[model samples]
Target: MDRNLELMLKEQKTAFYIFDSAVLKKRIMHLRTRLPERLELCYAVKANPFITKEIENETERFEICSPGEYEICKALGIDSRKMVISGIYKTPEVIEGLVSDKDFCGIFTAESVRQYRLLCELSEKYGRKLKVLPRLTNDSQFGIDPEELENIIRERDSHPMIEIIGVQFFSGTQKTSLKKFRRELEMLDSFLEKLKSEFSFEAGELEYGTGFPVSYFRNESLDEDALLEGFSELINGLGFKGRIILEIGRSIAASCGKYYTHIVDIKSNKGINYALIDGGMHHLVYYGQQMAMKQPFLSVIGKDSIIPDKLWTVCGSLCSMNDIVVKQLPLPEIEVGDVLCFENAGAYCMTEGISLLLSRDLPAVYIIKENGELYRVRRTFETLALNMPKYERMD
Candidate 1:
């Protein structure tokens, strides 16, 4: 840790996550400079809504996935024109509210025929015009089938309040195969051409989820720059003359965050070393990791030395045997108060963890601003209240 960060963390006595806003902006700027300029960058707010305010101006649009995400963007005062409401399970109340509000000018994506129908009904009832993108499924429950999407396009003229602006598609994440991406793009291009030929429908935009891979394990070797280069080449070569939007989340936010936990106990069980940490599976999360079989990016902050001189199995405060952080990690002579720093934890780790399992206290969150000021966003919060119900009379 740097001296400035260490000074700030010295005052924090509990496990926490620290995010660097400068790093976040640098990552976004890197993508903007490397990728095709014609492609618009859409930051998926589901990844890390905490940093949305810091990145709102840097991205062309924000992909809101849920009511909470929308509320976060709205609270940040992000322009509605720079929002794309995209998700599989958009609630009726939320959609109705967005459509009824005359000031809400964001675009909406239809994941299913039911969603399309709901949008049509709400738009007609509220007398508000809506721009929609019908998502095509990649053999998943996330989007509408190609045939069903065609039917919607055919009947679009009947619903004058709804306009089919483009198509939305997203494959799974942790994509390492460039060939697979190219194939998907080719299929999408062909699909757009078919729509143009059959119904004279020209898509004004195409919102695609890149699902870029993040290297969480030490063994995983990924050439991200090469992949982005090839991805941009493929997108630029596409014959579609519509606005192309790349919805990304993990790759942009992962590098800006780090998780910190301190050891509370150390013991030797049956010739095996064990170090108990304050945080566990409920706080630290990494995609595509199983039982700590692979080593993640971690470092030990010790008083004397930061070198690794011993192998220890780190466990969380949870009572379950499955609450292991790492199987066997190389570490220096660690004491009870030594801290462990886990890197690349800025993405889904905050929200995806099984936090309410044992009703453990959620860690504090801090952000280092671009001007080199450390600010605490959230203090250590107790989750037992969320797990327990309020006292009420039995009816």
Candidate 2:
């Protein structure tokens, strides 16, 4: 066990998430070093926006989807130009805010023809010549249809403010196979070439939202070298150079987080031994509804002396019987006072947690620095009672 982890387990008895900023920085550096020089790495703010002051300089750009996400980026001191606004829904106020900022050079993706027109409308009204990227969402083609793309371009030409810079496409996620991504690059080439041949406007960038899979439960590691090499070959072979942006999320921050929960009870049911912890599915699963098949890597802190001979069914403190974290898991003798640590939880665990569910307290957040210093980001807060709201007029 890490010294900081052990200290945290000993001092902080409540459920908390420990984010290792060092690991996150290292992961980002590793990714940046491996990717082609032209490929710009933009951190998807939705993954883990909990940035520490010390590591704030490490991340340059962010991909935001909503006003809340944009606010998070602003809170992090990120420049407005470094945020690429994506997703389908954008409030008129948010659009106005994006267009009103004179220094905002960040890219916004339009998923539909309606969204593109909306951007043009807002930008023209504000008299801001904003750089816009067309996001492919034609489900049938897995990209923007050529006819619709031309229509959007024509509409933008009619309005002098908006300029079409590039295209953005996100087909699917959790990909590990290099061959699949190679095929995607090939298809991208075809699409780009088709756009060049069909349209008169010149596209300057190609932002491909892709990244390797993070090892949550299954440990078939991604071949990063092969993927980067293959991608480079594809880009160079095509001889189409403009700008490349790689939008990454979960994979970058997954390994940097750890969830700590204290075991409250140990019992035997039928033919299995159950170790119940204070944390539940709300902490382990993303949506706090479905059970994740990937068994989280656990550590029984300070209890490595005993040999593992028992198959214990580890469960959370939720009322539902389906709140099992892991079942039939081989572990050393788990006691009621033992601490259970779940690794690889940085990306989508805490934000997706149902803290108000069953009136449970929210988990505390801590950032473990590279020097083994634990910085408390957020202290655990108890949920308000369901009947505590006194503003009821229906009596």
Candidate 3:
């Protein structure tokens, strides 16, 4: 039975694995090694908590988006003084809680004067000065209008309680264009200069929001050397004395992990074959969403001669029709109980998994090192079943 299961796993691609911290640390170290002395790297905690320790140990600072993430960092014993909070909507309680902590210095991504004033009041009540960075969106889906941003900054400057420390701009997720980034930076620089000259308000800092493209969906021909050079040029041109912060999430984690599953069934009709794995969209939703554009290829694990020659649709064992890893791919001949592996599952997969049905157990996670050492970082059944609420029958 065990041998059969092993063979079945080999036939079906199935495994959800984490990027080993050692590997991720090396990648981050490589990036930081080349970064300018004035620039600060802040790893976005929204990506994965598995690397939080590694990040704290390596980088100078970190970014948080939610209350849960902030609490996680606190629990992990990360230095809260080096953390920055950013989100579209922040509750009064959350703002109060963060501001009260002396170690916590936050930046609320405000869109209006009301938000700015409220945050100021909360900071005053907490007896702590909060650093604010206005979220700038330049003709993009996620940012406020350029004119609206300028207005908000001007309004915030009038209030003695609010301090406009810097400006932040996010171009959107998975963006891979140096030209677009350059344009956004230029717009921000011009606006900042105008604000400085007219209102005599010093734009203390600049934050380029996370959109650094990684190797998950598709690899673009981004010249790393040129990209950094362009970034340096922008910073130099701005001539702002404040520090520069990068909130990067995906680019740091995507290339380091893989999702694995075991094939449960197989079907063939009219020269077309289907391999169904134990896990699907529930485990990795982004893979399914991007299948139409960037289909994942299958490869046999621990087999020397096996190679993919025919295209097959890799589906999950879920009831949903859309639960698929790769809709079509030239895969090797697979059999029942084979293990299927999906690459680039590190970012936004485990952390963002949602239990749609709540019936299937969450997939287990493991980390494999360069020396072939495997560590079970988290278990599927244990974490999934813990704290499930029970309902009482009413008469």
Candidate 4:
């Protein structure tokens, strides 16, 4: 066994884990520097709040999708002016609560007249004009149709409570075609031009919703320069002085984290080997389903003579039959108590996990640094207890 690999396996005993924040910061800074004037990167809160404090300190703005996220931002002392609130279905309480607060400058993304009316009423009651953007559907499953979007603007403009600021469009996540994006941009330009000519209304901001690809998936690369150039050209063509905002969640946090689990048992079924680990669907569901094109790469720890011939299906300790980590992956020799590390488990894994079959506690989260210093950022037990709704309690 290699000494360094053994040390790495020893490090996997802890529950939840993360990569160095300093390294993450350097990556974010590089992205910011590359697209300085052309883009305003708003860190999406859905990724992971462990990095929120660091992000708030480093970046200028962020995106909030729910009241809970809004509260998280407030807790982090992020200025409300630098936040953009966006979601498809927003509750009345959230609209009223956020609008009534004078300190919060929120942008509501409306897809229907009902939501528009609701926002208008909230703004009227609060005695403050609420800024909003019509979420336009551009041949996509989500968002409002282009004609319906125009109608929404026209109908809502008469209301003194709502201030129509701009337009928003989200194609989808993990979009692979730049050509498709170009067509969408062209559609947006045509719509904006038509709106400006007919209604004499200029847009305040052109928000391109985020779906930028990350490197967690295999054979995927985001051409930073090409993307920036395309965005700059699109903005220039629009001829709007409004800001360009991007809501990035996954791409920013995926690479800077990993999930570490120990091999609890090894078995052979029908001439096929299987390595059962202590963690699986409860911690890393994305890996189980290969969501977002994520195919995990495994590395054996503490073993020098580990052969790369045996194929093993990585299963979880949970009793559920579908609780699998990796299906028939070719890997080195493994035994009970051997540790296996899965790269790029950061974005939605920890936050979206559920302990359904068993009451096993959530993992402990740690941020590992470039110089090998580890910082215990967040513990799962308390968070689980707090986030669990009171209605869910039987006692």
Candidate 5:
């Protein structure tokens, strides 16, 4: 922990998230350098839209999964050419509006035939050629089937305004088996070869969503270097010669964020020490974590003193019993006003939590620049205003 950051945390009164811009950039650069050189990194904006601007220049492209994500980039004045419009349920109005824009040159991903037709109609109506990637799903509701995709490619001549640039496929996230991914890549390579042989259509790109796993538990140790090396070898051995776009999110942003919350109360119940914190389940989330049964990286920011460790079950301010942050962790002597800092919270924790449940106030957000200066980006927001509704006159 940096002394300056510790001093800044001591001055805070409420739970908040502090993002390190330097760490974010380093994570992006690490992926770029570690992965195969032929593979282009596409930062999934849904992972932490707040840091998109901080890493926009470091990544080759941005995977925009929804309208809100697109707005985030637009607000940040990100270049449209670097955007990859994606997601299964893309709003027709939003897609039309984006396609109708005069300067819109970003690529769009079609998950189904309906989306394909929507893009074609908009392309024809706007009198502009559109670049698209048809996503092939692994028997899920997310994307079109392989047969359906083949039909679309076979009839590509009918839609001159639409150009099928390549294929996109994403199974899921937090994957640990390299063998599973290898099979998927092999199947995809065979499909592309079939398309090239039958329709004489060579895909110019392949946007693969690498569901890279992020180690979030004490018992989990992922060999990230070995995984990346194996995946890179599998991709390089493929016969398809095209641009490779690896869509990543959680793995890149999780390490750059830290969640801070202070202990408000402490008590003993039935031979157990319970430490209550201002932040709870509504503010923190880790993939596949069940009831905080697994231990995550956390530390107590307090005065330097030698003290014996004791088992403490950390809970949150929420009224629900499920608001446990961690269960029975050994820690030094803790007192009220002692802040607990949680690491690797930069990904889905903020938005995935049930924020509006208890009408609790939202946490403040801060960013640490590369020069070690801290800046507050958002103040603690009141969610009661959003949860409450206007009273109606029944009389």
Candidate 6:
């Protein structure tokens, strides 16, 4: 814990997100060091948009799937050239801009033949060749049919503006099963073999979304090195020329951030103790893993921390009963004005949470540079309803 950071936390008037750039750099670098040279790494903007120049330099590209995400990258001044779009719905208007942008030079995922045709139309109109990766799924989710993909490959001569890189498959997210992902890779190998033998697909990139977690909790950390090493073994000597592209979201950013809010009230109902804070569930991140466990690394600031035998449930200020940060947590005695700091919150917390449900002010982000310099990058934003015309009542 940095003393300067503690001072800033105590001085803050509202809830805030604090990110340590040094931690983020270490996390990303640790993974990158073990990856093969042929691997291309991308950071998912939905995880966190606080992309420092150091992070920007480390990342090969970004995966953005929405216009709002595009706006976030634009606001952060991240290069649009390094972004690849992959979403269920690829609107013509958005795709047109992404392809025509002078800086745009990355691949885009076409999940269907309809989308492929749209890309062809746009590329021909713009006089450009669009690089594309066919999204593969089992028909329960977003992906082009395998037969549809093959038909397009067969008719490759018809669409010169679009270049088929390779098929992209997302096995599962937050999956720790090595056997499952290995099987997925093996399946992909066979798929690539058929494409290569029959359709002549070569040097196409496999956009693999790495769905591993960096921080489940402080006690249980995933052995990323071993997992990635296993991935290296699975892909080794598969006879595929295309590079493996990994899109990492929460793992790279989560450990670097901590969420803080001062306790406003303390009460007990029946046998359960509750500590209510100004910041509620809406302002905090709700990771599926963390939510399932109902336990994340939490620090009580401003005191030496006494270990009293009691369980405390931290609740947000929202009136909804579901507005809870932690259902039950064993902690020392906590009181009003004491800060509750949620650890491993650098990713998915603020940006992905339902900040608009109660219309609470969006939490501001304060960044501590890798050099230990601290400053605010973004201020809290008021709700959209607050700024809307109050004179006319629609309801």
Cα displacement (angstroms), candidate 6, residue 187, comes to: 1.2
**Clashes by residue pair, model 5:** none
- Displacement of residue 339 (Cα, Å) in model 2 is 1.0
Model with the higher lDDT, candidate 5 or 6: 5
lDDT of each: 0.91, 0.75, 0.69, 0.71, 0.91, 0.78
For candidate 1, lDDT tens digit of each residue in 289-358? 8987778899877543556788899999988899998888888888898888999999999889899988
Over 4 Å off in model 2, which ranges?
1-3, 52-56, 101-105, 138-144, 218-225, 286-294, 385-395
Write down the lDDT that model 5 would get: 0.91
lDDT of 4 by residue, 272-328 (tens): 788888887788745225622235655776564666787778888778877777676
lDDT by residue (tens digit), candidate 2, 1-395: 77777777777777889888889989888877776676777777777777534345665557888889887777767777777888767787787786788766677788777778888888878888877888865365444666787677656668778778888877665777777777777777777777777765557888787855765664545566777677666666754577777877887788888888999999997877989999987886542223544455777877767788898888888788778888777788777788878888888788776666778887888897887788887888777765256785876
lDDT (Cα, tens digit) per residue for candidate 3, span 1-395: 23433443443344555566677877777666656767777788888776676568777667777788888888888877677777666676887777776666556666445566677787677666667777776564555676676776667645666677788777677665667877777777777888788767778788877476665444435566666666666667765677778778877777666777777888886876888878777787563355444665335555427777777788776788777677666667777766666667778887676554646777666655545465566666533345566799989
| Ranked by TM-score, top first | 1, 5, 6, 2, 4, 3
TM-score for all models, in order of appearance: 0.97, 0.90, 0.84, 0.84, 0.96, 0.91
Q: RMSD for each model, in Å, please?
A: 1.4, 3.0, 4.4, 4.1, 1.8, 2.7
For model 6, the superposed segments whose C-alpha errors exceed 4 Å read: 1-3, 52-54, 218-222, 289-293, 384-395
lDDT of 5 by residue, 1-395 (tens): 68667766766788999899999989888887788889888999888887888887888899999999999899999999999999999999999999989887999999999999999999999998999999998788999999899999999999999999999999999998899989999999999999999999999999999899999888888999899888878988999989998999998999999999989999999999999999999999999889878998888875445464899999998999899989988788999998888999999888899999899988988899899888888888899999889999998
Candidate 1 wrongly placed segments (more than 4 Å): 1-4, 302-305
| Model 6: per-residue Cα lDDT over 203-284, one tens digit each | 3678888687555554665787788888777767566767788888887888888888889999999988998898977777
TM-score of candidate 3 versus the correct structure, residues matched by position: 0.84
Question: Which has the higher TM-score value, candidate number 2 or candidate number 4?
Answer: 2
